[model samples]
Target: MEFIYTNPIGLTDLEVLEVGTQACTPTMKFGPGVRDMYILHYIHSGHGTYSAKGSSVSVVPGGLFLVVPDTVHSYWADPDEPWHYTWFGFVGTMAARLCKQAGFTGSPPVRNPDPSVPVDPLFSEVLSLREEPAKELLLTGLLYRILGTLTVPDDIPPLQPDVGLHVRRAVSFINARYADPIALADIAAHVGLDPKYVCRLFQQRLSMSPYRYLTDVRMRKACRLLRSQLPGIAEIARSVGYADPLLFSRMFKRTIGLSPSAYREKAKLENTPSGT
Candidate 1:
């Protein structure tokens, strides 16, 4: 059975365009055409061949194939054993980021996760929700869950070397909210860990406490602002989480070995044209 959504409008960061399942007959084929959105296929049974960029690859049960936007591709069920597959197409602001996180970068355009955990059930669930009132929202969540099965952003700790999941979340929280009045407790709450344990994780993995790390991130951002010399000292200070220019100056001197004005002057001199 095959189905397509009537309106396919993108409602949130991610949206499902259409979804369907089909069991191919012998030698069944489609495409060698291009699509404007991303379509992912999960093979449920049997085998087939997928071709893209002048290369062809055999896909079997428990395999996945991706069709990225504007990429010409073709797939055909095996002449003797044809395949049954479920697929969904999606387009969204977060689609590219999620696709990259899922390791779907087109070169091979295939993923063969552990065959023990099949993904057909998740795809089937998408079809099951076609008639619901909250169809779009439900489909979006299911899409994220489907992608979650493939991979997650912090699976390999891309932000820092040797950082565990909790620490990574803490760091991400700090990086995003350093300018706010957030505290270590907030970071711990975000990651669902004890504040003391979060501190311990940071000290062991990052050589600093969570609060200290937050300060470091703030000071680094302050340095960039000071170098630009655009915002006033008080504004710069507040932008980096300091409400008082005096306190920000003191912290800047302590962390950077120079006052904000001094640093800005130095940056100005260094950036001055040679002959001007």
Candidate 2:
């Protein structure tokens, strides 16, 4: 079963686009092709070979292989013991950086999880979240947790004293509460800073005012929901914190350069697979 999720919202760090499990038929293959996003497949059972950069790696149960964006690669199930696996596709500004941090940054990018790590439950939870609505936040958190386990604590550099700690906190606040009737003062209060100081920090760190950042977060989520085509305009508006559908339409078009319905149609066309 496979489900696609475009609800990125305020998850600027990483955005999960799709997740699924598949039991490959004998010798089934894909690629010598490229993808626009990163895909990570965990081999649950059976065998396969993943080839890239002129190298091939044999993958077995509990192994993981990563397909990097825009890189040509190919994989096929073993003719005798075909593989079953769970996979997720994702993309974001920070995706590649995080992938490196998780030790996934090389040719034929396949590796077995550390013996002490428990990864099955994390992937299982991702599959479960596929069946739920409004799972963007949960999915992002889960992905971070899963990647964290794959990383060596000693290899990770210790954090420096963050001068922008308040800015980061304020952004987290907006990410968690964008659907509510929130304002700059509320964000400032959450970060224990004065409203004007918060505004200055946002401008210095993010190059935008607090309200502009909030609108951007709301508009991004609105775009995703529109593309999904699963909710009415009014419902999508409310989900992104707008009480009035008309106002939401105006803001969406202003920020995204198309009405919600128009954007949906365009996304559908673009997302349609090559043939069917």
lDDT of 2: 0.79
- The list of candidate 2 runs beyond 4 A from truth reads 153-276
Each model's lDDT: 0.77, 0.79
1-276, model 1: which lDDT tens digit per residue?
566552433243566766778899996998887665688899888999999988888998888888876578889999899999988887643566677787776575887756655576787786678798878678778889988878745463344443466766677677778889898789989999889988887776655688876776677678768777699999999999988889989988887768999999998886687799
lDDT at 30 for candidate 2?
88
Instruction: List model 2 lDDT by residue over 1-276, tens digit each.
Output: 355564556555577866778889896998788765689888888999999989999999888999986578999999999998888777554566577778786687777755687787787776677656777767777778878888754365533345257776788888888899999889989999889988887766555688987887788678778777799999999999999999999998887668998989998987788689
Minimal lDDT window, size 10, model 1 = 4-13
Supply the global lDDT for candidate 1: 0.77
By TM-score, the best candidate is: 2
Worst lDDT 10-window in candidate 2? 154-163
Error of 1 at 227 (Å): 56
Among these predicted structures, which one has the highest lDDT?
2
